[model samples]
Target: APDSPRALNGISLTIPDGQFLGIIGPNGSGKSTFGLCLSCLLRPSRGKIEVDGLDTSTPEKYWQIHKNVGMIFQNPDNQLVSTTVERELAFGLENLGFPSSEIQDRVDKALVQFDLTKYRKHAPHRLSGGQKQRLAIASVITMQPGLLICDEPTALLDPRSRAETLDLLYELHRGHNITVVYITQFPSEVLHMDRVIIMHRGAIVEDSNPRGVLSDIDLLERFNLDLPPTVKLADALRRRDVPLPAGIVEQEDLIQEMRDIPRGAPPGDHPESESARPDPTETVMELVDVDYTYSKDLPVSTPALHDVSMQITPGSFVGLVGSNGSGKSTLMQHLNGLLTPDSGRVLIEGEDLASKETDLTSIRQRVGLIFQFPEAQLFEETVFDDVAFGPRNLGMEGDELTDRVHDALQQVRLDPEYFSHRIPFNLSGGEKRRVAFAGILAMKPRYLVLDEPTAGLDAEGTHQIEDILTRFRDSGGTVLLVSHDMDLVATLADKVLVLD
Candidate 1:
């Protein structure tokens, strides 16, 4: 244990009161570790962290530090403990010993502010991914700490929800003067921060204002970080003699610059569309008038899917998109018989799922489904065991099993030598997702059903997922991807499916 690698090495930084800071980095770069140490959740190995003139390493100061600092974890499931959404918001307030009436008032305000009033009485676990994220933030904000540290809080949200969350954080920073430390993979999200810090290999690589750091395309590329689309477009244009000014990171700025340039005549002809491909004669998976309702016989039953029907042909990539709690996840679960339809039928390769002759084990082996949260599926002691679980269960062993795990980890861009022996729980959010993906990839499934596979991944990690999906499709495997990222879906999917 003494020889183990340090998550944060000789890190020294200071944050003045009411200053909003942003931190970005690639997967496993110790951003989350730094946040834990700052919040006193994790003690530093060799250095000291002080907040409000109080040392974090001092046990007597921990309570005061916790009282003034609140953290929203990357995984909402880890922070959520109450049975209901309303109770979750009040749990912290009650712990801090707020009066009964004041607790009720704060809970009501949080429920309304986060747009969770509709699901006030619903169980926290039963909420959708975005809903759970909102609950996590609400629970933390209800306590109203002076320093708020958010770790990729918007990774699971849809576009609208993402914008709303950013706006909310900005408002809190500007209005309440809360010292905010926001950690995210999206460079675009940090455009408004007072300062930005880039971390890699457990060290701060760059520290400067957002514009100064983000405008450096070469610097971001060196770290395997993603440049905003507008910034990339501007850089490409400038390279081709477009003469665009520097520091163009926002969409509006780019648009204004383009408007100032002289416009040429409209193009004479639009680009021709690609030729339409013929439909497949056989459907690999199909849902026929399927319907499902959770807690069907209970008084508080909730309907999920209604008369859903679709077909997935062999070797085709299909994109599924919808708002949170719009049955996207519920629909994905039906593909592999994880949840049977309350009415109608699910057919896998022409075999009815409800039929006694149909084997669910075979269906699962052919179709590998990755849940939205990687934490739900990862439980092994080490990364090697987790990735090897699927293959070993199918009778693989010895050198063959070892090779399968190694190859799978390599495919996800994680070095087998470095990650094999590490605990899966200790990895960053993006790393955990990749490990779960490696587990599914090791199974060699014919069909890959992924729900938000790239949710918490960085730019390089996302590109790797795109490459993997493309390779899978080219190799005669079918894919049904569920994601809120429209650009990704457009680039990878052959066809798109919308769920309302």
Candidate 2:
């Protein structure tokens, strides 16, 4: 019998001291469930998990296992509970019955180590996404767990922030000799791991070194994951009969291959040297002299955007890239009048976006804004209820509502027959994301705006989402995406909009 459905199935693995392991899989492959079981966050129905020889089935042993294991969830907001950075760093110690003196000492040490001393007094919530993620790690580090498990900790962070968080984790692995178990879908991040394990349908499919695993292009495609850039480049070159290393997985390797190419060969003869083909008249989004600021009758409020002129157009996918606190979210909030500009104007169709009487609701209906972690917006009990909420809110009813809900479920790829009655909370992280997306799709919006929609998804989930968005565009729905995925932006966006 399968252990509890949320528990491991034929899953057996061990981490010797000082190992870095990266796990990859499609959504619902039980990667996170396995991690949770190991972390003692969830109990297995039949299988036993042991930490340093302590069986996890016993309450005392479970507690003991937790004392040595620390988990950082995908969302920093879910893990951070302290009002200030200093307190957040100290939270773990305080919970474990550490004395006040020791707790203070750990807090200071963690703050210094994480380079958060300057913001020790600042509220954690006010910190950038990356900063908040660092604080979450700092809080866990204060506990000094022997094994660290991070579940997609950088899923929704900006580029700089993501790099910083990865750097911090790598530092912890090298400096502290902490055994690291990381779950992620970002090929960029995975390439840096010492080892990678690929999971599919609740089982491990491939376990090898990072470079070796990613080089298996066939295996990656089988699991719905993309080859890393280096591997992809190598494969592309190979197809064109260019000489290159078989498992290239980084820029250095690609550069090495290129440098070794025949010195006198024409640039056009080498496929690797070929420039991107130019296309004529690609429509780009344009924003002209737009200014926006928040106000509430008080005089001290700060303006979020000022004279920000930009453009994004048809067949042109663009990224609104920025660090947290750099006004990325606020700017998107203005696209459909969720927040109106006080000065200047925004135009999508060369029409003003500031009129109070314009069918703003209809405008919202056109532009789908999936809030950051759309699960925050899910309120219904059953999957059906949750997905049906949006269309119903739009005044959809009777057979129309039913038909719309069914189509929406299909859009997110959730089987309405199996998932309709399941409680929203019972679904896995990937399932929850789909449910949330289904709610938005039920609205039948013309322009779609998403915020970190794939934060907790695995490689398969991410690919599915990208495909869905592509299809939506193909079906004539305009997309304005907000993501922490630079790779996705590079792969999908026709243009780039660096917000800060």
Candidate 3:
């Protein structure tokens, strides 16, 4: 029995039919592994996994359990295998031996449900992060499973897309009464769940109603989970002797509570130490007259960056955020010479990045660019080899390469000895990300550019990443982070960049 390696470690929980449950934890806390076990992706090392009165361990029941439970993985790209959006959804239904007419009917219904009818012929690869995420969900929906388990489904999506996915999930549960088990790292997302299961170090730390669980600031802090902004703002007001209504989790509720409270004199009118509040003049990175377009003659071509100018100065952690089609990815690709501007120029360190044959290698050496879902870039046979890929390519060999690889692994908190020989495919989602970060860190670039670096991490993994970025900045390294996690930006960034 393979009980010792990937054991569940006394996890005992139950979800009744048609109930919605949320699983939360830091990275490697067994949240995803537990979900995978439930979905039959990984056979449990120990313990029982059952669904709809069927034991998962029995061979005959495996097919039955799988037929009733559909799982959507954390990464959109990994789960997606079809070329066109429509075909992707249809493949699952067709494989189940559904009649041709029924298969087509289900596919049409799913497309409408996820609002992907317009993109029926679109390739899954070309769709934006949010669109890809929705397509994955659509494929699962077409299967018509009684139980739906989503592992951080919105991790890579923009704010609007994340919101839309959440809305769709709620609708699926409400209208169809499908049993749903959702996992997420965002504190606000957990606030709406009917039930919450918190995991810590591979065990259930707490399981209760959202309000009861979230109100315990001490427990959440101990687990490195951030309090929702509304709760934090309320706590700040409470510290200042301002009374607020209980159970407020959203800005609207806080606004309502503020209206009910006695009107205090405005800060300018009051003697509340206005001298302490600093003006917002800090800048970290700046771009001027940036002009970029993917193609010149294509009728569908549009400028990815057009006369765009912005500033983010030293020690100012900024977030670049936008919707799916808003060109956020294209804009970032230019930061490290992954893409060049069609016209105009970009400057870093007062040196032009768009000038003729700009020393791109040096530019890249100075700025570490981590792509979206960077974990997928891992191709080496061992973890050490994967992390050492970048530095080795940079001409570091022998002892120097070894030292950089070790240091980078430690920076991401991955155990060097245990992970050195481990294949990247065998690592968990969170571990793979840290490995990706280690690869970039091995280069020791002064300015780090991350694109959705924490895309699929849970609360614990997100915390680890936030700590890593903060430490990088404190050490005098600048970071140009591209992410859709606004809450993360609000908590860690000194500035915010909204791409149109």
Candidate 4:
């Protein structure tokens, strides 16, 4: 372990006061480790991190340094220490020995600003992944840290929530003069930053303003970093001999570029467009006037869905887009029989899911639902056992069961021969996501639904999901995906359902 490569090598840098900085790179690039060092959570192996002339390694100055630089981790569930949302938000203030009145005031302000006031009394664990992420950010900002180091703080949020959070951070930097260091894998998130650092294999390779960092398309591709959607669109248009201007990275530029093209056939419709056409098959599943509400007895009971109806066609790819609390996740749960409607019925292949005689096991075997976090669904000791659990439930056994498990793992780009015997908990985040995907695919479900499938995935992991989704549709499987990635939706989905 001591001989392993360093996580942060020659990563010397400086951040001025009130600067909005962004750090991005591929997986295992030491971005998170750098943030930890800045906040004094981890001491640098060789160099040092200083916050406001205070060395992070100084033992006596540790508490003061931590107060000066607040950090919000990628996983909100891990950051929340209290049972209720309000308690969690107030924990940091209480630790700083703030007065009761001030703590209440700060907590109230955070609750309203983050749109979390309605669920202040709800358990943190009960909140959606996005909501939990919001709570984590709200909790840290209430501490009034001068330098806030965020590690993928908005990774689990919906598109609207993610944009709103970034906008809030920008306002905090401009108005409160807080130095913000934001770490993300999404290229578009850094477009507005005052400065951006590109990290690779634990080293800083590029340091420049937002335009300089995003304009170099070849550099990002060499490092396997993803291009922003608008950048990709501009590049593609340029390759078509349109010769559009360089440095185009916004949606408005693309709209203007399209307007100059004279609107021939509405774009994307060519003579050889049969392969790209969407042909819907017979209905596989349908929801009729569904209604659902959570915590009916509580004082803050909220309706999740209201008279929502939708149909899932066989072999068709569907994308569900929405903001947090817009019932996207709640609606996805109904498809797999995890939540039943209050008044309406769910039809699986024209058969009523509400019928007492219906078999849930058979339905679940035909429909697979992947949660936002893969760890929630992985419980078996070994990877092989975890993937085989679903198939075995359907009475599969012997060599037949093993083949299904192996093939599914291969579909997710995991070599079953090497990964089968490994412990599920020992796998990395990306590996765990692939394993979880394999577990559901092992069942050979006709329909698959995923919630934010690529929330924290890198470019490679994102490509793997895209390939799998395409192959699934080509083989007559139905996929309904909920995601914040508009680019992915445009590329994969034939039809889209907007929730809010």
lDDT of 2 by residue, 1-500 (tens): 34445334587777778888999887777778778877888877767778778887888777778889999987789888888788888778877899999999989998888778877877787666667777887899889888999888877677777787788888889999988899887765877778889887788878888877877888888887767767877787778777786777888878988898987644345345443524435443345676765443534344567778776565445566777556777778878777777666776555566765567777777778887778777778899888888778878889888888889999878888898989998787667888888888888887787776667666767777888887887676667777767778877776667776
Query: What would the per-residue lDDT of candidate 3 be over residues 152-249, giving only the tens digit for each residue?
Result: 88887887778888898888899999999998877678777789988876889898998777777777778877787788788877767787755677
Q: Which candidate number has the best lDDT?
A: 1
TM-score of each: 0.92, 0.84, 0.84, 0.91
The TM-score, computed over Cα atoms with residue i paired to residue i, of candidate 4 is 0.91
lDDT of 4: 0.87
lDDT for position 311 in model 3: 70
Q: What are the runs in model 3 whose C-alpha is more than 4 Å off?
A: 1-6, 245-247, 250-252, 265-316, 340-356, 379-385, 406-432, 458-460, 474-476
Better of 1 and 2 by TM-score: 1
Error of 1 at 57 (Å): 1.3
lDDT of each: 0.90, 0.77, 0.80, 0.87
Model 4: residues with Cα > 4 Å off, grouped in runs: 3-5, 250-272, 275-281, 379-381, 392-397, 423-426
CA-RMSD of model 2:
4.2
